[model samples]
Target: MELVCIECGKARRPENLFPMSCECGGLLEVRHDFRRADAEKLRALFDSRLALRTGPYASGVWRYKELIDPEVEEAHIVTRGEGNTGLYDCAPAARYAGVRKVWLKAQGENPSGSFKDNGMTVAVSRGAAAGFRTLACASTGNTASSLAMYAAWAGLRCLVLVPPGGVADGKLAQTIAYGAEVYGIEGGYDIGVRLLNRYGEELGFYVCNSFNPFRIEGQKSIVIEAAHQLGWSLPDWIVLPGGALSNASALGKGLLEMKAIGLIDRVPRIAVVQAEGASPFHRMIASGGGELVPEPEPRTAASAIRIGNPPSWRKAARVLRECNGVTCAVSDGEIMAAKRVIDRSGIGCEPAAAAGLAGLKMLAEGGTIGRDETALVVLTGHLLKDADAIRMPVPGPALEPLAPDELLARLASVR
Candidate 1:
């Protein structure tokens, strides 16, 4: 497999590579050949090995071997078995939205407690194999934690650059646990990403962020797992929240590959759910500019969606346009409401996860999504990873238990 330049579509190897879009400027990305034979064999394999917990199959993601990539050895996949997430056949939610079939891709169940693991597994492994001792990336929350975990397993030094606005405490805890160098940049994730890209080039550090092609290869497995679980039927729509916008592109690649081998007939319409704070991609879709422009002052409680400047905005724009997709921006209050309902459904998705649900609700209410559309909204991360992050109107400290009357008297006095 070879990486392709997004600009020239020129193919190249990934090891110790640099962006050609430099002095001799051009947009580019590492591309992998999607053509593969015996693709239908995976369906038969799943039927035969559905309940086997022996050997590598026990690892949730590893069950689909051909989908994910690992550099050193296939066994050392750097996976906590991140894929094979539970899909809920939600009748109530479906009925509410008036969709034919509504399914939930609960990505919160991943190893890192977030969907970022899908990329980290491949990125960190390839980074280690490429002799990059130190790996770095700019993140909102989940990516930092996910990279930290994988880097620790790969025995590589990890650095996380975060902005003040996002970067949830739970995610930061993982970075600290890996003994990584954490820097809080005063600016947004884009500032950190640009600086890291420059520093990584000069300092010979590995940028294991979404820009790395290996990450997309790893994330593509989500769609693979989804299709297999669905008995090879593709959904009419797959709604997801776009931060840097890598996931949508990766998923499109997966579905397209499956389609090539006759695993499915069509790729689903991709819907990007974004926060009102910063919605440049949404604005692009509306205007059909397909160009990137930075957001001045993004404001929203869905901190993960608060990317003022997305690095992969161009590719993301292309994906939206090509897939006949639409981007919807939801407010913070609506996000919280969606979170509560998602929690009640036993999904336990974090705020970032709820962003998609909020968008689905909005789209349905506005009659943008037809009743005939069968939608699958991805619940992108685990709320348990950041327990209190979503709770609105936070209550005071927990009350202490006191002995019968004495405790009651103290409480009464305080009141």
Candidate 2:
């Protein structure tokens, strides 16, 4: 395995504490020499691990350890049995998206009630192996909660910097409940991230943010496991919300690798969905592509994706280009409408998760995505992760004591 700079093509050995970016100021990606890998044998091996009831192999992220980080020793691996999330085939979701089939990859089902657990396990494990005493990150919510939970389990001090008044109550509570030392920064998520990048080394803490290559490696398992569940069949498209763009970049890397290794015959097209209020990535793509201009004050009710200047934008842009992907921004109203449909289907998700479906609907209507093409939408967080974001129904008149006959009459009058 080698750490390769995405832009300069410079390769280096993986270090105990690798810098966030390459010397060329480009992001580093984990690259493994899989040319000699036996595709069928590895596929059989992965399938065999599904029967194991214990240890790292059981983890969805570690099950593909050879791909994630082959150098990490088994003893150093820290896990909370994360990344066994299920895939749901919902009819209502399909109808709403105007697609023939829709599979919702419920990443929220992970232990942390968000997809971050998948990446956190690998990142924290790497930190523990490197003998780090502390882990830190700037988060809107999900990343903080996942890092804090994993850090507690790994016996490492965790620090989180969140934007003031930006996190949902449930997510904030989860972060605090996991025992992380939390700080509220004056500005937004981008400002908090800049602070971490500038001072993380001086503070003597390992950064667990998505900009860390290991985090993206673990997140790749979302696409890998999804393909496995579909019998190694490639979907027509994989749609996901773009926040820091870590998940989008990881999905592209995983799919391309799978295609390279004959795990799948073709790479699926990717669609990145962003909330209109926080749509820097979408705007960049829509404007014929250039250097990403960060949003100064990203506004969105989807707190999880309320990031403006995502550090991983370059990586994600490359992925979009390679996979023939498209990007779109959806209004908050559209996001909520799509969320209601998924919620009514009994597969509820947070607002950010619904952005993918909303974008898919738009694409379908715009004639970009065909109605017959199969697509998979990844829901990054559980419904309760941001319970406060959900609007409550208006209360009806208070009920009075009623006789059995009166109740029967009322029931008969109901639909």
Candidate 3:
């Protein structure tokens, strides 16, 4: 497998794959030799396992392994059977907002309870194949837990760097329980990023950041699976809570590949959703340049989405203009409200998950989506992953029924 520089169109072998862009500093995208005929030929690889009526992995994502080059071809995927998560048609959540057919891509079903499992499956799969003894990432929380969980499954050493006071106990517990070396950094996520990057280079550790092309390769299959789930039909739009921008960008690449293979006729407009407190890409959309505007100090309950400087900024911008898709930011209050709102609808999710739902609601109100349009809103991780970050109005423990003469009666009844 090889990649071509998107800038100079120069091809290089995978062995010489540079994790970041070259002298021009352009974000790299993989180039495949699979032309028209190969696209149609791609699905046959998983013909025996294809289950078209259900989730896409039952058909496309897992089927498109030819397009993705894993480092260890012979190594079994380190999935706790992560992919093929059930998609739900959220009737109650949709009815209140005049939404027609809102489907939730609940990635929370993954082993560590998040979509990070998808990328980790590929990361751990490749790391094992490539003979790497160590794997690491700098994360807000979920990615670290995912990396650690999958590394443990693959029997590889896992190193995690996270922001101090930014992570929730549930998240920290998950990572530590997986036996990863958890380092709580005094700085922010981006600072942790630089530290991890330099650390990877010095220690020869395989990085699991947004900058890693293979990690994105694992993400692309999400689009493939989504398409297959809809019986090879593409949705009108895919909404996601954007932080690193790799997820949306990779989804786009996956859709285009499917179209190249004639599996889908069109690409969905990929809308990137962000929390208003740290909407850096929203600023880029307003400024009319791919260059990210300086991000403001963040404040939001959606701590995982508090990314001021996303590394995949430029490519994310290209996707925005290319598809004419727009970026939308939702207020922290609305995100919190939506968290309650979704829970009321029996779909409990974190604030970042709520942010995506809020963004979708905003788009629907603004006529960005037609009432009949099919939409897939991704809830990236589980609410349990960061339950502590959400602010409740009042602290209350579980209550038993109050007696008529409560204080005295309860004292007698308590015994």
Candidate 4:
């Protein structure tokens, strides 16, 4: 296995403490050597592990370890029952989006109540195996929670840097509760990440951000597990909300691997949704797919996706083009409306997660997505992650003490 630079195609051994970007200043991705493995035998092995029900096989990510990283020792594997999130059949969400069939992959059901757990489990495990004493990341919210939890499980010191007053209270509470040393930065997530990149080596900390290749490898299991849940059938479309854009790239990578191995015949088109206030990727797509231009001051009510510059833009853009995918930006109002529909269906998620549903509705209305085709929307986080975003109830009658006869009369009149 080797780490390949996405821009210059330079290959380097994965030996450094934190191998984030390439010498060419581009992102790095893990490249594995596969010499035409038997697809049936591989599928049978994965299926057989499901029946064992213990150790690494029970983990949704580790069960596909051969595809993720074949070199990692079994003793170094770290897990917390992550992955295996439910693929829910949501008829109400289908009706709302005007689709014939819809499935909501509830990633919030993971151990940390977000999709970040899928990546953190592998990243931290690799960090531990590399003999790192400390793990760190600059996060908006979810990443902080995940890193802290995984680091705690691995018996490593954890550090998190966040934009002061930028993270949601619930997520901030998770990092603190999980025993991570938190630092407040003057700028946003992108700035914090830059600071970590500059100081991480000197501080002896392994970076656990999306820029890490192992994290991307672990996140690939989300699509892999989703495909397995559907009985190896590929959906017509895979829709997800994009923030740092790592998940989109990982999903595409997983599907392509399966295609190459004859596990699937065709790759599903991907759809990435971004909040209007923080839509650098969507803007890049709108601008004829040229070089990405960062949004200097991204602002959005969805705190989880309020990123100005995504590190995985190049990888994600390539996947989007290869999959013939489309990108769209939705307003906060549209996201909240769609979230209400999801909440009513008893499959609630955070505002950022709801952007997928909102985008699906827009695409369906615009005829970009056919109503007769099957689609899957990925919900990235739990509803309680952003409880403050929940709308308040409408004003009602004032409370007042009254006699029994008067209360009876008022109730009868209202009825």
lDDT of each: 0.75, 0.90, 0.73, 0.90
lDDT of 2 by residue, 1-415 (tens): 8888999998888773566777778888888888987789889989999998899899988998887888999999999888889999888988998989999999999999999988889889988998999999999999999999998998889999998888999999998998999999888778877777767878888998887888999999999999989999967999999999999999999999988988899999999999999999999999986889989889888889999999899999999999999999999999999999988888899999999999999999999999999899999999999888787664444266678998889879885
lDDT per residue for candidate 4 within 1-415, as digits (tens), equals 8888998999888765444787678889988876667889988988998886679779999989988877789899889979989999899999999999889999999998999998888888888899998999999999999999998888889999999988999999999999999999887899888887777877888999888999999998998999888888977999999899989989989888888887777999999999999999999998886788889989888888899899888899999888999999999999999899898899899999999999999999999999997899999999999999997665445355778999999889999
RMSD of 2: 1.8
RMSD of each: 3.7, 1.8, 4.3, 2.3
Instruction: Please give the TM-score that candidate 4 achieves against the real structure.
Output: 0.95
Candidates in descending TM-score order: 2, 4, 1, 3
lDDT for model 4, please: 0.90
**Against the true structure, what is each candidate's TM-score?**
0.89, 0.96, 0.88, 0.95
Local error of candidate 2 at residue 143 (angstroms): 0.2
- Which rank order by lDDT, best down to worst? 2, 4, 1, 3
TM-score of the candidate numbered 3? 0.88
Better model by lDDT, 1 or 2? 2
Query: Among all windows of ten consecutive residues in candidate 2, which has the lowest summed lDDT?
Result: 392-401
Span of ten consecutive residues with least summed lDDT in model 1: 19-28
Tens digits of per-residue lDDT, candidate 1, 1-415, equal 5567676666666663565233333445545454664666867876666687565565555665555552346654555656768988876667655677778888878877878887787777676666678889988888888888888877778888998746777888877897788988877788887887667878878887777777777788788788888889977888898778888777777777777777788878888988888887787777767466778677777667778777766666667667777888888787888888777776667887888878887888888887777888888888876676655454554344557898778779989
Candidate 2, residue 310: how far the Cα is off, in Å: 1.0
TM-score of 2: 0.96
